[model samples]
Target: MPAKKTKPTWTDVKKNLASFDNPGLIALLHDLYTASKDNQAFLHTRFGLGDDVLKPYKATLTRWLWPNWLKNQNTSVTTAKKAIADYKKAVGQPDGLAELMVFYCEQAAAFSSDVGLDDESYYDALVRMFEQALKTIAALPEQQRPALWTRLDQVRRLGHQVGYGISTSMDELLIEYGVDARRSR
Candidate 1:
């Protein structure tokens, strides 16, 4: 009987990588960076070498969350969420992660408001992201918390306009976090 072939895993890849010289590794990374924009973004983010590391991630979120209707673009919560996951993998900086999450909620809410979206799943995603943003923001320093919370407050207002109990759920989450969502600021 023929032996079964095993698929290559990270261990195999790491062993191969360990054999490469500095120049060889550089060449391999160059090839990978050239192979895809995602790789380029990942490299730039991992090294903190870009003026705005979050730009590519934000563009992806905007594309998936607030697709151009007239251009026949389609919304994709999964793809939008994937951009956040990718950013997390590259750097996972708390401020950057919070910014991306808040931006996601903003874009999704804006799309729902502008397009009058009636999809329950979309609203559910928006609400879930809102809570996630709140939770992430809570972990940041006190000085950073105010601005992010203010932005989420704007998202909550947009949710009210969207209906489907989005605003109600947001209010409850804010209370759970001890936040005065309607406070004068």
Candidate 2:
């Protein structure tokens, strides 16, 4: 009988990597850096090498969340959210994560408002990310909180323009976070 074939795992790859010397590892890293834009972004973010490490991640978010409908582009919340997850995995800086989350909320809300998207699932995802942005921003330092809050406040206004009770949901979240919805308006 033929032997069964199995998928290779990270452990298998790591075991293989255990044999490499420093120069070999550097060569492998160079190969990875040149292999793909994603690899380059990950390496840049991991080492804090770029002038704006978040730029690639933001571009991914913009592409997935706020696509150009005239060009037949489609939105993918999963892909947009994956960019945030990828950034988190690269460094998980709290302020950076908050920025990306707020930016995610902003892109999604703006798209919904502009397109008049009537998808229930999309609104649900937007509201969820709104709440998440609030949570993440709330955990940041008091000084850091203001700018993110202002951005989310803009998102809340966009939600109102979206016209699916998204603004109401965001208002409730703002109240829960002690932001005073009436004051935020």
Candidate 3:
């Protein structure tokens, strides 16, 4: 009887490639990209070769922050959550996720005033954005984390003036993040 053949796993392939030289690695990548459309697309997006690298992400934030017709609190919260997840999947990896979260905070801030929205519902939605951002800061590099926190502090100050900062949870989150909620300025 013939012996069973095991399929080649990614671990096996990675081990084999451990001895690859620069040119060999490049050649292997080129071959892999050529062999699979998925590989090509991944390389394009992953290496910033694709145009509109941040287009979809920008659009996602815009849609929630500034809806085409009217601003909806529920939609904003849902969209912001989805945008955070999308950012994690597409851009956030080892170092740059904070930028995306900060961008979301900015959008949420602008979103507060743009539609003349200053109610608790909308503010709560905005707070949700801040919460997600705060949660993500731990994953960011030390150099990047403070900048995001600074932006978030600014948002908290502004949101407080506008009524979104009324959420006790928001204040708690600020303290939890080691932010001086009293000196948001």
Off by over 4 Å in 2: 1-5, 181-185
TM-score, per-candidate, Cα-based? 0.97, 0.92, 0.59
Better of 1 and 3 by TM-score: 1
Off by over 4 Å in 1: 182-184
The CA lDDT of each predicted structure is 0.93, 0.89, 0.66
Better of 1 and 3 by lDDT: 1
* RMSD values, in order shown: 1.1, 1.9, 6.9
Question: Candidate 2, residues 95-161: lDDT per residue as tens digits?
Answer: 9999999999999998888888878888898899888888998888877787788789898999888
Tell me the tens digit of each residue's lDDT in model 1 across 1-185.
Answer: 99997998999999999999999999999999999999999999999986999999999999999999899999999999999999999999999999999999999999999999988998999989988888898899988888788888899999989999999999899989988755625
Which order, best to worst by lDDT?
A: 1, 2, 3
The superposed Cα distance between candidate 1 and the true structure at residue 137, in angstroms, equals 0.8
Residue 81 of model 2 has an lDDT of 92
Ranked by TM-score from best down, the candidates are 1, 2, 3
